[model samples]
Target chain A: MVAVDSHAYASRLRSWHPAEKAGLALATMFIALAAGSSLTEVTIAVLMLVMTVGLAGIPPGFYLRLLALPAVFVLVGAASAGLSVTGPGPGAGADFLVAVSLGNITTGFTAAGLSLATGLLLRSLAAVTCLYFLALTTPMVDVIWLLRRLRVPALLTELLELTYRYIFVLADLASQVRTAQSCRQGYASWSNSCRSLGGLINAVFRKAGWYSRQLAVALAARGYQGQLAVMEAEHGRCPTRAAWLAGLEAGLLVLAWLDRGHYLG
Target chain B: MAETVLLEAREIEFSYPDGTPALGGVSAGIIQGSRVAVLGPNGAGKTTFFLHLNGTLRPRRGEVRLAGERIRYDRAYLRELRRTVGIVFQDPDTQLFSANVAQDVSFGPVNMGLPPAEVREQVRQAMAATGVAHLQDRPTHSLSYGEKKRVALAGVLAMRPRVLICDEPLAFLDPQGQEELIELLEAESRRGTTVVIATHDVNLAYAWADQVLVMAAGKVIGTGRPQEVFQTAGIMQQAGLPTPWILEVYRELERQGWAAGGSPPRRKEELLALIRQAGC
Candidate 1:
């Protein structure tokens, strides 16, 4: 997660307008979902994969590893979808060519089931990839700015920004506490480790309250009003680039429409 | 005439909500454009006294004045007071709220309601002054401790306050970081901003401050030029502070026949020069 955040900050396309990137990703994802063709899903997934890895400068291996995480879930879901139990009552049909029988239970793979599984797997992978493309390229700061531009309430946007900032703060505090505990041989024995773990949790809870008070003092010193008014990140919109992305999405959808088919292999 | 009093507290008394005495009839005047250091041991009310200076904490029995005007507690006047007297707390983690350095530095100027371009310029200038210009784009969490301190200083500096107060500014700093910060504070003083710092390091106070104020048990035990204030052995002991090395060495040299007659040195370089002149 930390690596993904740093990569977004270091992304070569970071200066590009955030709205354009988010818009393009959202449009492609919706198109793939509505089209429902396996080929269209493949195109969306592949397109997002290349953009995230090649364009966004995230390492290809890392991107694939993240993609593989979803693959596990999709595989289990698709496997279940493809399986049908026709308990000895109905014989295998032409569509259900592959069958396995264990005692009275007969499990068979049917054409309709396989197709549904394929569609599910492809659609999910495409959606995950599209979201990853957006997250890996555009920074959370820009996304928050985009939210503000889209008329999100100041309260919600400020909360999003503050929450993102605190995630690292809490993680850093946790590591510090862990380090302190280990230095004192707090984890040397089983009972000691259990006691130390309990103390660490308690300290973190107390520290959260203490740190918030400190933050309040600092904020008051800075003349913080009811709202956190910060400088908005500026990104010039490029008409030609937006047009190009639109063209690419339209072309992919057209090709998917022309190439729709039905087959069980 | 005496230097114009930039900030003053007259017979101030304060106690924590639990009735712990933090200040007891403390009084001190900070002169305009003076590089001053408030020195004492722990629980000497250095922080409590500082809070009163900017009206962050009001005095229970006394009053604080800025340039002969009593500090007002109304929202608009308090905002003006903070704009004139900006403070950078010792802990950078508590002080820095933004995820990025540039945004954090812009917070003060933005609160002042400056134009966008002016805020940008202030942030840029503050980053440059603190030598964090290159790290402007870096995440606040990614910075080293020294870098974070500089970023925090930049955040306060961006406001361009007439008076800059730093509580225990040198705590948790490496020697190099300390030197750089001293130089930065000195430069700020040269720019006509009254720089008030609280510290335990007598050496830093001796070398850098035009005037020194020593506190003990919530009262001003000594206040004068560093040479005069540090020479008072009784005050130093009461305040739980040792005489600075330069002063000690210089006096030792003077006590022996090896030293020639001269003003006491507050810094090592000056002592060394005197030793060289005396053929020691």
Candidate 2:
């Protein structure tokens, strides 16, 4: 999360209009989901990877490392979905290719199940990459700007902005506590490590309570109303670029429709 | 001497919700266009008294008046009072709520209900004034402690308050950051805004402030020109405060008959000049 937050600020495209970036990434992801084809999903994933790593200048290795974080869960889910049980089948009559049999209960990978899992894995991955592109390219402040521009509820936007800012704060506090605990040999053993974690969590919650009071007083001093007013970034208008991105997304949709039945194979 | 008192609290008293006294019959008046420093040790009610001045905290006893009028407790009155007096709290982490620096600075002006263009201009000017214009796009958490402090000041200064109160404004700044903040506040003071800073650094209070208020426990033990108040050993001792460095040096020189001055120097260069003037 920290890496993504920092990288968004340093992105080569950080100065681009946030709405333009959100529109392209979100529209491409939706197309991938709705198209329901491996070609569409694969294309979307490839495009996003290029945008994040190639265009945005995030290191290819770091981008892969980030994607690999969720790959384990996705792969496990796919494997679970692909596995099937057949009632003492002699051949592929039960759609089972490879089987492990214990008496009359056979466990195997069915052709239909395997294809469904494959499709799901590709679809979800493409969706994940689309999100990564957005997260890696646009800072949270700008993202909130886009949401407010879209008229998302004020309460929700403020909550999100505050939560995002405090996540870094708490994470920093947690790390400092961990270091202090380790310096005293508190994490020298498994039992001590558990105890140290409990203490750290307790302190964090306590500090958060105190922090809110301070925040309220400071906000009041500055004449804060309930709504948090953020200034709009002047990226200026770029209709030509918008046209290009819209045309590109439209082309992807057309390609998805043309290759609609390829995944069924 | 003829300057109007911008803010005055007479017999103001307050206690924490836990029943501990935070202020006890504290009274002081801030003259407009004068730089005043509130000096005390920790838990000396400097902050509690500042809150009262800015209408953030109403005195449980006595009254706080602005421009000779008793402050009303109504929302509209308090809001108006806040517009004229802005207090930058000690901790920048608490004061800076927005993730973006420029946006954080815009909070005060936006709350003032200025038009979007004016708010933009205010944000721009505030950031520039505090030397954080380059960091306008930076995230709040990424800032150094000093940068955060400057951003916090910018956040308050954008409101264009007539009187600026900084609670321990020098608490966490580096020597350079402290120097920079003093320069910024001095500039604001030159613009005819009343600047009040609460600090434990007697040297800073002595060098920068024209008037000093000494607080002990929860009461103001003394208030006067820096020369007059620092000369009172009883008041300084009651506050657990030490005399400024230059003043002490000057006293030692005078006692030794090595130096004689028209008045005490406020800065090191002036002290050096004093030595030269004495032919020491």
Candidate 3:
């Protein structure tokens, strides 16, 4: 989470309008999910990867690693969808690509099941890449700023602002406590490590509560009147960039429509 | 000379909800446009007393006055008082709520309900004053401790308060950071804003402050110019604070009858000048 957040701030595309990036990501994701075609899904995934790694200038190795994080789940789910069991089969049906017979039952990879699995894998990965494109390019502050402009509730926005800021603080506190515990040999053994983990969690919670109270006092001193009002950063309009983004989205929509059943059969 | 008392606390008493006495009958006056340093040991009610000044924590028994008017706890009055008196808390992490440095600095001004242009001007000026204008786009978590401290100070300064109270402003700062911060505070004071900082550095309080307030046991034990307050042995011992080295060195020179016949030196440079004269 920290890596992604920091990278978002450092992205080359950070200066672009957040709404444009968000709209592009969400629209591409919607196309990938609704098209239900392997060609469209594959195109969307490749396009998003290029946008994030090439256009946004995120390191290619890091981007690949992030995409790999969700690949395991996709592979496992697709494998389940692709495998089939047949009962009382002397020989597996022609639909089976490879069959293994054990007693009266047989397990095999059927063509229809494999096709469904392939489609699921492509669609899920494409959607994930689209989401990552947005996440890697847009800082969370800009998203919250856009939300405020859209008239999102002040309470929710304030909560998001505080939560985003304190996550680093709490993480730092937890790491410091863990280091102290480790130095004291509190985690020398498995049992000891368990005890130390428990203590670290307890300490972090107590410290977080204390931090919140201190934050209240600090806020009060700053003339906070039940609201956290702050100026939104100015992101000047870029019509050329918007035009390019619109053209890209139009291309994706056309591909989704033209390749309606290219791979389904 | 009768100086205008910009902010005063008269026998203010307060206890925590757990019945722990944080302050008892604490009274002190801050002169307008003066550099006042609150010196004390740990848990000497310095922070608690500062909270009262900014109307964050109302005194249980006594009244706090700003410009000779009694402070009221009403929401309207507090809004006015807070606009005039801003506080920079000790921990910049807790004080800086916004991730963006510019946004954090603009919080105080935006809360004052200022027009958008004025708020922008205030934020810009505050960031410029604290030398954090270049860091406006940086994330708060990425800032160094010194940078965070300056950003926090900018946050308070954006309010354009008449009195700026900083709790332990010098703690956790490197020598350079400390020097730069004191210089910034001095500049703010030069602008006719009363600046009060609570710190444990006796040498700093002596050298930089026009008035030194020594607190112990939740009460102000001594309050006067640094020369008079630090010269009183009883107050120094009672507050568990060491005398500034300049004072000790000057007193030894005087005892040896080698010191120049003049007022005692309050700063290292002044003491050095005296030594240079005596050697000549």
Ranking by TM-score: 3, 2, 1
TM-score of chain B of 3: 0.98
Winner on DockQ (1 vs 3): 3
Local distance difference test, each candidate: 0.86, 0.89, 0.91
lDDT of 2 by residue, B184-254 (tens): 99999998999999989999888889899999899999999998898899999999898898999999988
Candidate 2 vs candidate 3, lDDT winner: 3
Supply the DockQ value of model 1.
0.67
Q: Give one digit per residue, the lDDT tens place, for model 1 in B188-221.
A: 8889899999999999899889899999889999
lDDT for residue A105 in candidate 1, whole number 0-100: 74
After superposing candidate 3 on the true structure, give the runs of residues whose Cα lies further than 4 Å from its correct spot: A88-94
Worst ten-residue run, lDDT, model 1 chain B? B257-266
Order the candidate numbers by lDDT, best to worst: 3, 2, 1
Q: Pick the candidate with the highest TM-score.
A: 3
After superposing all C-alphas onto the true structure, candidate 2 shows an RMSD in angstroms of: 1.7
Better of 2 and 3 by TM-score: 3
- Candidates' TM-scores? 0.94, 0.97, 0.98
